[model samples]
Target: MLRYLRQIEVIGVENQKKLSNSSVLVIGAGGLGSAVITYLACAGVGKIGVSDGDLVEIHNLDRQFIHAGKIGIKKSKSAEMFIKTLNPEVEIEIYDDFGKDKSLRISKYDLVVCCVDTIEDRHKINEVCFKNKKPMIHAAISGFEGELAVFDFRNSGSPCYECIYPRNIHSEKNSVVSPIAGIVGSMQALEAIKLICNFETLNHLLRMDFRYMEFIKISISKRKDCPVCSKNL
Candidate 1:
């Protein structure tokens, strides 16, 4: 409690306890994952699973701070080292290989944070989370813009990632202003904490343009024909 004394004052002791017992799986160790993992570990999430098969590269340092000085190593392993050093009390798990076949692994966590870079990866994660009926926090960054949304599949009526973006859309590597990743990633972590503590979370897609300091919240509904979520419905 001492470690989270200030936070407990805001969320209460019971909520703090909920956080300590919660498990979160972060599916990327890149830019967004770095911030998401850092704050979640700092907030005392009991277990964190990091899944990223990519290796650290020098170009990643501008945003992926967790991999500092660990270039050439596996990102999941680098993330584990960062979490252990930041909060030894938190349990850490690393997955060097993540794909569509890891649905069982997704079922083991209380929440899933989708911080991956590609639209395809997001679809894969969305499918698994929707199938398992788990809450998923998703965020994406490009240039000075980012978007966030929570698909709480625990509720039958909640919208999902594919509900907003169809699977037919493809993603290409985009340039990003580093701070945008931090801004959106931190919000993802906050959403996860709020969900674990039974607080009201964002029920709409939040789009931000940091360059202009603009923020927009758009209402989202389940797509009647969404391939991933509609089938379950």
Candidate 2:
């Protein structure tokens, strides 16, 4: 604790302890996941669970920083090895599969970070978190564009990912550059750190258009028919 006291003092021991006691589930091991997990461990989040069914591809070297030089490795194992070298204080668990509600009993974690690229899994995680009343940090990137949002389902009036991105709208292919994924992934990590450290973080949908270096944020409204968070709210 003393070694990390400089950081713990600002975040506070209580919050630090809270972070140490908390575990976060990262649903991807690609670009966004690489940056998200790297910082979470650095901040001393006690346990991090990573789930990804993909193996490292050579093309991932551009931005999937965690799996560098370890292409062809399983994502979970790759991420575990990455963290083991970064911070021994942070424990990592691996799930070598996609994180569906049926496959993952997410209640095991204090929070969930959805960094997966697919809208299908995005909806799955959204529904599961809302049902279990877990705090979720969500992010997506395509091309030079990115979007981020946070949903604390247990918090009154907090909008969910589905509130902004209804299923049909998000059905488009999510094409993204490796750096774009890293940028969004890092933002996801920042959100998680803020949540765990009791630091103030964004609660609304944030959109970034790197093509013009423009950023716009709009409050996420809860839809009355939001299947994911309406009833839970």
RMSD each, Å: 1.1, 2.0
Worst 10 residues of 1 by lDDT: 166-175
Highest TM-score model number? 1
Each model's C-alpha lDDT? 0.92, 0.84
Candidate 1 per-residue lDDT over residues 1-233, each given as its tens digit: 89998898899999999999999999998999999999999999999999999999999999999999999999999999999999999999999978556778998999999999889888888988988999999998898899999999999899899889987765656679988888899999999999999999999999999999999999999989988878845
Q: Which runs of model 2 end up more than 4 angstroms from their true locations?
A: 2-6, 99-104
Residues 127-187 of candidate 2 have per-residue lDDT tens digits of 8888788888998888889989989866767888888888877455566766787788888
For model 1, what is the C-alpha lDDT against the true structure? 0.92
State how far residue 44 of model 1 sits from its true place (Å). 0.4
Position 210, candidate 2: lDDT: 91
